[model samples]
Target: MSTKTLGIALLGVGPGSEPHLQSLATLADSVDLRWALARSNPDKARAAVPPSTRVTADLQEILADPLVEAVIVATPAYTHLEIAAAALAAGKHTLVEKPLDVTLARAEELVGRATAHGVHLGVVLQHRFRPGAQRLKQLLDSGALGAVQSAVLQVPWWRSQEGYYAKAGRGTLARDGGGVLLTQAIHAIDLFRSLVRVRAVVASQIATTAIHTMETEDFASALLTLGNGAPGVLVATTAMYPGRAEVLELVCRHATATLEGGTLRVQYHDGRSEAVEGEAKSGSGDSIMDFSPDAHIALHRDFFGAVAEGRPPTVTGEEALATHRLIEQIVRQGKERAA
Candidate 1:
């Protein structure tokens, strides 16, 4: 006797196609990929997936397909709300990729709809499962780091000129939401807020200093006063050389902890520091595209488990909405400063 597999419909198969395909393939036993939706390029969708899998431009086709119990919305940022809402309304579970939605209001609507329908809704915040990051979170949870005073996030990720130009909506406010902070650094920022128990973000400021081409900022920094009265700094840029490392360092009363390149380093006030090793996906060239299909797989596994056990997924839509509100506030502050 075996458990029945959940059927899934993939809602986008363009530039960001392979990772989701691989993730589905890895969990094939648990997931039946019923359809691949390509509203933009149906030919590209056909080429991206195996001939055995079905292809359709209509999301309703997937919803009507009795086999599809869930939908993975991999469309562009702007269309996430529209597609995800449809999937949820059709009585299917949903796993939407990061940012949840470009705006706080849309995210809230999605959460409310999912709750009303009694369906599981998850957001892809896979970075939390990284071994080193998980260990650091554990330490902080145990109060081993003591009272966290402040933290800094340095994510100087690099993207090639061609990469930015390749997509019409790569660095635009209309499509991509914002630049590095919203796209790249939100993962780290979300983690920072989670670890610090950031109940209230008192203030935020943003600016575009480095990348002149993009409508949004390539370089920006912000100072935040957390609800618990802890201060923090977030600095991110897509303009850097030789690639850049994503680092998060937390200063506490008893010890200071830093995580970078899969290593967790902690310096205690007693003149002792310890290092715990980990591994992150690295590219052959000097590009900061450290994405892993395994991360997406892990995310799927959790979603399926939650559906079967009737529990909430690790990154629920409601929790992600909180992060979206924070980002909206930051962007509003940035716009004010520019005005």
Candidate 2:
């Protein structure tokens, strides 16, 4: 029996493109980075590809290749559903970047199609892959952490005009999804949901106060009651200057788990705390800052592992639907208050 190579075709070569390439490089022997489909410009795709990789402007050509086993939908927010749907229909495993889709309806469409097609449908919520997060997961599962009680997420980052203008469709309701919470803060929120095991958000109040220029909320806060009956607070603001200082902290009966700067810190009731380290990137200001790439690398490893073992991917489509629903609820509730 030949070891099957998972052929991956990258659909977008935009800002968060490098991480997937790095994952392909890191997992070179396991998965093949066969092709890149840029938007009508194969040159950009060609430039982004490492040697022995094909670059094409035609997504159809990539999809038509029998060797291509999966499609990584790193396209913009709005195009995720369409691209992912196409990939799933093509019988390819689909890994979509975050936000999944702009609205709950589109998200359902993609999630539903993937389910019917019986292909692996995963989202890149990579923060959950950090060693700190893994340790926390183990601790919680082992009952070392008694029960999650409360959580707080603070994502204060800044974005400038230059970063907004860098892309034609950025920060718009149509393209980038919402502001910080939707694009930037969702990572923290998703991780929060995972740590606390939030199944259903009961009743909540949402408020949006800062950043008026953008179509969506730049600053928003919400109070949520998780399915397990834990209460938590989520606050995301892009109005803060000097770029990113993302933090996700959860307080359980046994320990206080905190994640920041790719490091997860846990202070246990037994008087022991450990820190998990992550890779570093040098960047300044809000507009150009993101953790999607690191998340993608982590996501890739898990997806490939699942494929190899014939198991489900970590952040499955159904799981992602809950995250999307949470965001949608917050945004809708915030809008109602604003009205």
- Strongest candidate by lDDT: 1
| Cα-based TM-score, every candidate | 0.90, 0.91
> How close to the true structure is residue 19 of candidate 1, measured as C-alpha lDDT?
78
Q: For residues 1-339, could you state the per-residue lDDT of candidate 1 as single tens digits?
A: 126788788888865556778888878787788899988778878888867679988888889988888888888788888898899999999998777776667778889999998899998777676667778888888988898888877776666556663457777867877777777777877777677756554556666654446777777677788656888777777677555567888899899999885578999999988887766442212333345676667777888888878889988987788777777777777677778
Q: What Cα-based lDDT does every candidate model obtain?
A: 0.77, 0.76
Residue range 109-201, candidate 2, lDDT tens digits? 999999899989989777788666777788878987778788777777666656662457666788877776778778778877777756554
Q: Which residue pairs in candidate 1 have backbone atoms (N, alpha carbon, C) closer than 3 angstroms, thus clashing?
A: none
Cα lDDT for residue 117, candidate 1: 88
Give lDDT for model 1: 0.77
